[model samples]
Target: MQRNGPIALAFHSLVVVFMLAPMVVVCLVAFTPENTLAMPWNGLSLRWFKAVFHHADFMSSFGNSVRLALLSATISTVFAVPAALAITRYDFRGREALNALFLSPLIIPHLVLGVAFLRLFSLMGMGGSFGWLVATHAIVVTPYTLRLILASLTSMDRNAENAARTLGAAEWTVFRRITMPLMLPGVSGGWLLAFINSFDELTMSIFVTSPSTVTLPVRMYMYASESIDPMMAAVSTLMIALATITMIILDRLFGLDRLLVGKG
Candidate 1:
């Protein structure tokens, strides 16, 4: 057992290295000095980042992405919380099926879903608009919010609400004051997940975006398709940084660990 331990350790280390190697290469190449992609040995510079800023369209796309992410995340969470509460707090016919449908998006392919939405929007006379994009994004991110809120609601005890009701508290009061505070962690976590989902969405956005409604991911896709540039990597790196900052802010505001499987 001891003799094989070193081999196992080395193998796992190799696996990790393999996974990280591409990211390391991307970071290095983003700083390449040459017009075309090259290695650091030739020289390294922040010229690509400057190009990304000077492009101006990149900033527009970034702003659009932020707006879309925030709007979709908030709207999705709003719908998902009520949906989760209804499923968990109230018994009803077809509850199981409803829950399944809410979660089905996670299993469905985004590309296929995007195509379906494009058709649906066309039929409804709402294709290729910000409204359509927001609705589609909300649907895509709904599963994340639903799952988190459902888990949180199930883990939370209803004894407090029952006690409050027995003491003459109204249903709305119990829900808002007691249940909501307890479920805040899951709700916040759901919002974070939804934000990330909408912010980084690609395939769906590609099908639905109009010229004016284009998001950063769609813009990046267009740029990468038309011209393979290091600016793609720079934009991606900025997105990662922003996502990290958002996560930190959310975790600080709401207990990140509590929403999963544990009590705070």
Candidate 2:
């Protein structure tokens, strides 16, 4: 008889508990009647959630975040996928260095980029523009898309494309007809990750945002600066729900494990 794995299961359970605790706490606090967020036992009420729904500023910021995230994710995917194809399909000088350069966004501090963009926008006489925000978000989101798209390209069998070309299919036809479908999973996963990164981004968004063009994270920052209430908890809980739903949808699109941790 085979024995069950005990330590492995226990460790996995602990990790899940740890990851869930903060979200659970925030969800509970969202219903608290008290002004302060405490864990000791207090009566629960739906008042805070009601206020969160009614806030015009919150709705506006949420809409802006969605718009920017969609725009940035699409832009990043289009640019990065083509760049990834070129880098992976053809041998070029400085290949490794160029890949590193594309990934530099991950290393650079977002706050620094924020300030740089602000100064650049001002110098260009385009300060406080929505296009600037979208452009900055695309830059930030590009690396993830490139990484996944490259991996997809690597997983592909070169023989098929060679055969397609041998059979009279053009280079563009080979890519469009054979390669694109195989790479869809990675492209999709990258797009979702890019959108989430843009949605959750705060530091970079601060420098780009104006009163008329603020994202949700910026609104949350401003709100936190002024108040410490259950309303924030309600908003946080809603965000957590959205994140969970997004992950579930992504898992359905491309197996979540394979998307994040490469398949053996």
Candidate 3:
């Protein structure tokens, strides 16, 4: 393997710092003793963090985001598995078209999707409904799950499946015992990625979400527009902490290198 030289290493370190600087600044600002969104240079205080918990709107928005992420991620995973199996295991007319349809969201901008969904929901008289919001998010995140499941299915060895069938195992049994297990890593990784995306989603959500179903990002955006305070910084800090904790849990349970990069 080629090792990075000192210059290359320095450049990469700078890139990492650049990417992380904003988040680091936000977190630090969250600890500020000042009322404004400034760094905690004089001293640190938990006032903003406490305020976030006590704030009804933020808490309600947080709950909505969690439910949305969970439902959308699970729904997408359930659909992606069957769709991936059909695409990878069968050869049929329009097979390529079906695959492209499943992946088209990756190419289409979210802004367009939000507008399309908004119009569709209005026509169906389902505007601002939590159920419809979840459905739209599921559609948006399905491509991520589908791609991961497809990669898992394609890279999987079929010998075990063949052997099981030859041994008189039912097709369903073979799939349940062999195929599902083999693709579990992909399924899990895809679900996590989908959940994260759905949780952090903003543009599409802003259009689809109603007053009652407002998500955290949407709420944060509204708050930022109305005020400039350490409370927004506090909210951002909490989100960053949530993401960090999730990554730590995933790394501990599955090893990030294995789950993310397919390297054990």
Q: Name the candidate that leads on TM-score.
A: 3
TM-score of 3: 0.92
Candidate No. with top lDDT: 3
- TM-score order, best first, reads 3, 2, 1
Q: The CA-based lDDT of model 3 is what?
A: 0.89
Tens digit per residue, CA lDDT, model 1, 185-246: 78888899899989999988988888888899889989988987778777776777777787
- Cα-based TM-score, every candidate: 0.88, 0.89, 0.92
**Tens digit per residue, CA lDDT, model 3, 27-106:** 99999999887889999999999999999999999999999999999999999999999998999999999989988988
List per-candidate RMSD values in Å: 2.6, 2.9, 2.4
Candidate 1 clashes: the total is: 0
Which sections of candidate 1 miss by over 4 Å?
A: 1-8, 42-44, 246-264
How many clashing pairs per prediction, in order? 0, 0, 0
lDDT scores in order: 0.85, 0.87, 0.89
Question: Which runs in model 3 stand beyond 4 Å of their true positions?
Answer: 1-4, 248-264
